[model samples]
Target: MTMPAFVKPRQVIGHHLVLRDATPADAEFIVALRTDESKSRFISKTSSDVSQQVAWLEKYAQDNSQVYFIMEDREHNPVGTVRLYDQQGDSFCWGSWVIREGSPSGYAVESALMVYQFALSLGFTRAHFDVRKGNESVWKFHERFGAVRTEETELDYFYSLSREAIDKSLAKYAKFLPGGIQVIAA
Candidate 1:
């Protein structure tokens, strides 16, 4: 059977938030979050310059191997970002999840659910990602979502979640996105 191509949906609308494809215009916002002292501690470091981020985004536009998104609330206010990449057969990796401080509650759960739903729709059966060793809250969240600890390194904890686990998590958190998400075509 022919494998499915990665999807780059224009939008994935949920109950409280919507994820839209990232653009160069979001460079400053992305840079701001990536450079925030409190938020940057767990994720990889990036250049603080918005122009650099713009260049990176321009390059990213040509790469179909990944999908990057900027999350927004109903009013179209930017709140966070997430990405899916590093595909290997039926498995894919997702990361760069960061939500703005002071945002309303339940966003985290909704974002995770939306990500899994979007990935599943693209035909990915499993996911593998690493959480920083110091990011206890994130790792714990994944554990509670049924992701298994597969290994670890000096700075990060690797985890794996099968399709079954993903489905379970989606069901468990169904309340957060009771109406499910609406994916708009690219």
Candidate 2:
């Protein structure tokens, strides 16, 4: 049997945010963005130096196992990033972060929606994420997007959403969204 395609590049937009894949030239910005203490807390890995970041970026450019996107404002200012990885079969793991302090509201939610839409476009049936413990706000945010808590472990809380759930959440939020929120297929 032939393996099915489950990945692709995509662009998504919200009222004040846009999400798209990172380019080779984004290494420097990514390095700076990931080094922030607040931003790095929830991330599983950290770059110790610029060279390390560059190497990671090079690998990311070549890797089919992961997809990364930079979140930007209306004026094209970078505010944060989101990544989807560990894709196997019909499930994938994902995460997002806002690198700049108080850059704007809605960065995380916009990034989340982008990733969810991307996953659906990729033929994924479900998506999952690990939220750090004690981050009640983040938990609530995920729940607001229709991610239900699926598992609780010593390190983090796991949440998941199926394609049906994602669609329902999007439809439910459509009335509250501004005119700019849209998911463009890759």
Candidate 3:
């Protein structure tokens, strides 16, 4: 199904930032973001060449099971991206990588909000993600959203949360978010 244009365009956040879908045109930026040493280390993936990135973006654009969005700053500069994929039944997987390198305040919050919105749009009962084993900061961040660790491997830690849990957690933190940050489902 085709998403509405309003939802497809830039989603504003308190007049400071926007979140929107990524395109094949974002290949260069995505390559750079993926290559950043710190980000790469945590994500456990190597950077792709421009051609490879373009191909990957093409595949993503054609895949209904995945949605990727680019986060832009006030000036409309693309700074980072988040991806939601692997939808099956009521379960889906999510992943995010921010390569803004000293981004403004609330970037992480914005990313989390996007994840919540996407999961809801997909009608997912639960969303899951994995953080590298040593990425304590990210693990704690997920915990703050009420995500519980369900599995721990030598290399990564897995976290999952039900739809009810996500909604309750969002409600619990609503007062802390910026005004106009609506969670829209597809």
Candidate 4:
């Protein structure tokens, strides 16, 4: 079956950033972004090889369960990467999210709000992800969106945010979403 547009939107526009689908051509950037020294400690280990990244994207292209995006600034400069994955019954998982270390203050908020809006628009009732236990900074970051801790593994803390909860938190960040988040039709 064909996945919905929110699962693989060609482009998602926010006030300060635009998230575009990651193409095979973006393999190099993805590799560099994920392997960058500054951001490496926050995420799980990823391939440093371009060819390996390309192979992964090729495989991902066929897997409707995962969607990758390259987040860029209003001027179209790469900011970071994010993904919505593991589409199952009524919930999906979201992560692979990162914003460039020194990107302007707004990029981080825009990227996250866009993803939560995208998931809700696509009919997902809930979203889940795990942040490293040591990453207290980001744990607090996700809290801004009403994410509640659901699990605590030795290495990570899992969070679950319901669409209802996310919606309630939208107003707090509404000023950051330019067009006020275009919710796709069901």
The most accurate candidate by lDDT is 1
Instruction: Please provide, for model 4 over 1-186, each residue's C-alpha lDDT reduced to its tens digit, 9 standing for 90 to 100.
Output: 444433576887778788888888889988888888888897989888899999988888887777788998879888899999876666778889878778888777878888888877777778788899898888998887889999898999999888777887777878888586553221
Query: For model 2, how big is the CA root-mean-square deviation?
Result: 2.9
lDDT agreement with native, every candidate = 0.92, 0.72, 0.71, 0.81
What is the number of residue pairs that collide in model 1?
Answer: 0
For model 1, what is the alpha-carbon lDDT of residue 147? 92
Better of 2 and 4 by lDDT: 4
Ranking by lDDT: 1, 4, 2, 3
Across residues 1-186, which tens digit of lDDT does each residue of candidate 2 receive? Answer: 333244545667766777777776777788787777777776666675777777777888778788788888878888877788876678788775555788756566555666666676667778788898777788788787788888999878998877788887767665434453466666
lDDT of 3: 0.71
Q: In angstroms, give how far residue 88 of model 2 lies from its true place.
A: 3.2
List TM-scores for all candidates, in order. Answer: 0.97, 0.83, 0.83, 0.90
lDDT of 3 by residue, 1-186 (tens): 433112332353533556677888999998888888867778756456798888888887767667788878768799888777766566677786574788876777666765675456545667788988788888898898888899999999988887877887768765445453544343
For candidate 2, the per-residue lDDT at 97 reads: 59
With candidate 4 superimposed using the best TM-score fit, by how many Å does residue 67's alpha carbon deviate from the native?
0.9
TM-score for model 3? 0.83
Error of 3 at 37 (Å): 1.5
lDDT of 1 by residue, 46-114 (tens): 899899999999998889999999999999999999999999888889999999988888999999999
